[model samples]
Target: MHRDTASQRLHGDLIGQPGSRDRLNTPALILDADAFARNVARMADFARRHGLILRPHAKSHKSADIARAQLASGAVGLCCAKLGEAEALAAEGIDGLHLTSPVVTPPGIARLAALARRIAALSIVADHPDVVDALAVAAQGGPPLTVFVDIDPGIHRTGVASPQEAVALARRIADHPSLRYGGVQFYCGAQQHIQDFAERRAAIVERTDYLSTCLAALTAADLAPAIVTGGGTGSHVIDAELGVLTELQVGSYIFMDREYSDCDLGDGGAKPFETALLVDAGVISANAPGLVTIDAGLKAFATDTGPPAILAGAGESARYRFMGDEHGAVIGPDLPGIGARITLGTPHCDPTVNLYDAYHVIRGDVLTAIWPVTARGRSA
Candidate 1:
C-alpha cells in the first residue's frame, strides 16, 4: 500500500488510502490499470503495424496521466474535443494537441491562438470561411496555427456540407499567413458505432469515397492535405484498410464501453480493445426479494447509450436497470445484499467519464492510485 505524496497533496484527504478499494466511496470511476496498459499497447501496436500515426482522443479518458501513458506508449499526439481540454492537457506538458471541434467564438479563437503559441504544436478543425478567417485573425503575430478542413461525411453535424466547401476552406486556410493547412478531418461520428462489421465497413467505404473526392478536389487545387485525420475505435481497422487516413483519432478504444462492445468487428468477433473502465458501486438497499439497489444510476453513468452492464458481483444472473438519477436496480437470483460491491461497465465511456471527478486506479483488488479527471466538464 504505497501512496504518492503529490497525489495526497493535490487531492488532500479525499484520496483513498492504498489497499482501500473496498473502502472507496461508491459510485466512483474505477480504472483497471493492467487492462488499460494492455489496451494502450494493443492500439499502439495496431497503429505501428498499419503504418498509421496514433493520436488517441483525450476526450475519452480526459485524464492527463492517461494521456501521458498513451504518449509514452508511442502515441504521436492527442486529440481533444474542445480548446479547454487541449489547454488542460497542455498545462500538463502534453504536447502535440489537436482540437477536433471547431472554435468560432471570439473567446474560443483567442484561447486557441494563445494555446498554439504556448504548446509545442496545436491544430484545430474548421469547416467555414468565417471560422477560418477568425482563426487566421486570432493567430496573427503568433506561431502558425495548423488548421484541418472538416468535411462532412453525411453526419451534417459540424463539418462542411460538400467536398467543394471543404476545398474552399482548405484554400482559405492555406492562403492565410498565420494558418497552415494541416489536412482534412472527415469523421462519420454516427457510423462509428454501427453494430454489424460489414455494415460499418460499407459505411466507411462510402465515407472514404466522399473523402477521396474531397482529397481529389484539394489536390486539383494544389492544396493536398499533408494529413488526413479522422477515425474512431469502431472504424480504425476499416480506416486503415482504406489507406487514406494518415492518423487515427480514436478515443474509446482505451476504455471499451458496453455500447462499443456490442459493435460487431465485421469479422464476427468482439471489439479489438479491452474493457478497462468500470464503475464501482455498493449495494445500498436489498430490502426487496431477489432485487437490490446500487448507488449508481443516471447521475453516475451516461444514459444515452442505455443502462450500464453489471460486469461482476451479484451472481451470474444479475441484471441492471436504472431506477432513478442516483439509484440502479439489480434484479436476479441470489442477489448480493446491502454492503456488497459490484463493478458496472459503462454504456458510453466518454460521457460516463465526464460524470466523475477522478479515477480510482486499481491493480487487481488494491487501489493503487487516484488521478484527477483534469478535463472533466471542459466541454466548451
Candidate 2:
C-alpha cells in the first residue's frame, strides 16, 4: 500500500501537469470538482427543504477539505465510521462530530473523552451495556459524551435487535456515570440500494417503524431520544418524509457511484447526485482482440461490489474486469488502443476511495487540485 505523502511530500504534481487527462497515471483517483460541488449543494438543499439536519458521513471522502465544503454548505456536522476517523477530523477542528460505530476499548474511549473537550458536541453509538460501561469509565470526570443506542432494524449489524434491547441500552447509558443518552441510530445499511422502489420503501418502513417503537419505549422510560439518526443517499428522501430521522447521515450523495446510479429513487430519473469521483488509469497493454488493459485493478477499487464501470473514451458497453493487483481489463467493440486513458466509475465509492492516497480534482479536462485522504488508514 502506498502511504499518502501528497499532503506532505511533493512528488510529480498530477493536478497541474500538462496532458493530465491523456497522460497515463497508474492507479490514480480522480474527482470532478464541479460534479462534487453540485452533489453537495443538491443534498444540502434537500435537507433545508425538508427541515432535516445533514450530517454527511466522512467515511466516504475522508478528506478534511471535502468535510469543510459540506460544513460550509450548511451541513450540521460530519459522521465518521470509527473513533480514529473522529480523531482525524477533530484534528482539523471539525466540530459537531459523530462516530457512527460502537467503540468500546479503553484507549478508544479515552481518545473519545479527550476529543469531547475540544469539539462542540462529540457522540458515538452502542448496542450493549458493556460498551456503555466501558465508555462511562473512560469519561469518568472528563466532558460528558453523548451516547446513542444503535438499533439493528433488520441489518443485523452492530446494533441492538429490538426496541426492548434498545430501551435497555438507553437506560444503561443514562445511568452510566460519564455517558449521556443522546438518542437512537437505526441505519439499515443492507437496504440502502435494493434496486426496487417498493422493496426499498418496505424495508425503510419496517426500519422506521422499529425506530418509532424504540423512541416510544425510550419516552415511556422517561428517556426521550433527542436525536434520531440514520439513512443514506438512497433512503434520505423517504427518511425525511417519514419525519422520524431527526438527522440524516447520508455520505455517498456527494459522489454518486455506479451502485447508486442503479437505484431507482422512484423519480423516473437517475440519482439526484452527480458522479464526482472516478479512477483515472492508463491503458497499459493491448494484448488481444476486443481487449484492452488499464493500470487500475483490485488494488484500485473494492471488489465487494464488483469492478468499476469503464467511463470515458470509446463505447458505452465497455466492460471493466479485474485483471490482477494493479491492472484492469476492458472489452468492447470500440475499446481504444494502448496508452489510452480512461475514467472508471467506481462500483462502491467508500471502499474504493479508501484504496487511494489522494484525489486529483479536475475541471473538465484540466487538472486543478489535489486533496489527501486524511483518514485513509484510520480503521481502528
Candidate 3:
C-alpha cells in the first residue's frame, strides 16, 4: 500500500519557529504552520456554527496535503478548477472531488467519468444541454455523475443566462440516464475581492436574488436542485444569509492574500480571514540607495490581484514592487542589507501558489519540512 504516513510526519514538524536560516535562498514559497492551522480552524468553526457545509476550493493551495488538512478540519469536500487538478488529487488518494469548471469534450468527459468511480463524490457544472449530453454519454454507469446547472448570476461568465434556461437544462440532466441533477452552481467571480464592502454586498444581493429566482423556477418545474453551491471566501457570509446555498465552496480562507486583506468585510472594516500564505525571498542586491532587490517577482508571485506586501515586522521597512521575472525592487526606509530574508503576502493566493513546486514550512527561521504542490499546473 502506498503510505500517506509521510505527510503526517512532515506536516507535524512545520509550524512557527525562529532562529534557523535567515538568508538561505531566494524566490521560495513559505508556509507558517501555526498560522495555516489557525486559519483552517477558524473557517471550520465558522462553518459548524452557521450550519453550512464547507467545501473549500482546493484551487487555492492545490496541494493534496493541504486538502487533507482541510478535510480533517471539517471540509465536506474539495473544489478544483479543472480535470487535471482532480486527477492529481485522486493520485494522492483524497476522495470527494468536485470540478468547479465544466468538462465538455470527448477525452475530458471520458476521463472525468472514469474518475467518478474512484472518488466518494464527483460533481460537474453544466451551462447548456450539449454539455450535459456529453457527460451522460461518457459516464455510462461506473458511478453516477452529479451535474449542477451553472447559472449566470449577473457576471455574464460561464453560467446559463436565464432562469428558464437553467430549468430546461436541469430537466435534461434529470432525464439523462447516466447523470444525477446536483442543483445549481452560481459564483460571481468578479465580486470576490471588491475592496468596498457596500459594492460587494450590493453585487451579491443582486446575484442572490437571481439565484433564488432560478431555484424557485426549478422547483416550479418539479425539479429539485438538491445542492445550490456557490460563494468564495469573500462572500461566504452573504451566501449564508441567502438561505439558498446548501454549501459554501469558499477557498482562500486558509490563506488570505494581499488583495483579500484589503477588502472591507461588511461589519465595520475587518477582513474575512487572516493572511497565512507568504513567499520568502532574499535580498540579492542592496547596492543602491533607497532601492533594493529581492529574488521574487512576476515568476514567483501573481500580479493579477496586485503587488505583494512585506510581512509585518520582518526588518523590512521597504516596500516590494515587481520588476520582472526572478527579480523585484524594494522602496522604503532602512531596507534590509544584502542577504537579509523577507516574507511576502501574495497579491493572489491561487495563481501565486501555482508557480511553486513545494512549500518550505518554517516556524521563525527553522526549516521544518516541505509539502509538494501536487495539483500545480493542472489547468486543464
lDDT of 2 by residue, 314-376 (tens): 589989888999888898988888877887898999998888778877787777777778788
Ordered by TM-score, highest first, the candidates read 1, 2, 3
The clash numbers for all candidates, in the given order, read 1, 0, 4
Residue 362 in candidate 3 has what lDDT? 67
In order, candidate lDDTs are 0.87, 0.84, 0.81
What digit string (tens of lDDT, one per residue) describes model 1 on residues 67-87? 999999999899999888998
lDDT by residue (tens digit), candidate 3, 157-272: 68899989998999999998888998888888888888777788888898788788898899999997778888988887777776778888888888888777888765565554
* Deviating ranges (above 4 Å) for candidate 1: 1-19
Q: How far in Å is the alpha carbon of 67 misplaced in model 1? A: 0.4
State model 3's lDDT. Answer: 0.81
Q: For each candidate, what TM-score against the reference?
A: 0.95, 0.94, 0.92
Query: Using lDDT as the measure, which candidate wins?
Result: 1
Taking all chains together, the TM-score of candidate 2 against the true structure is 0.94
lDDT of 3 at 361: 68
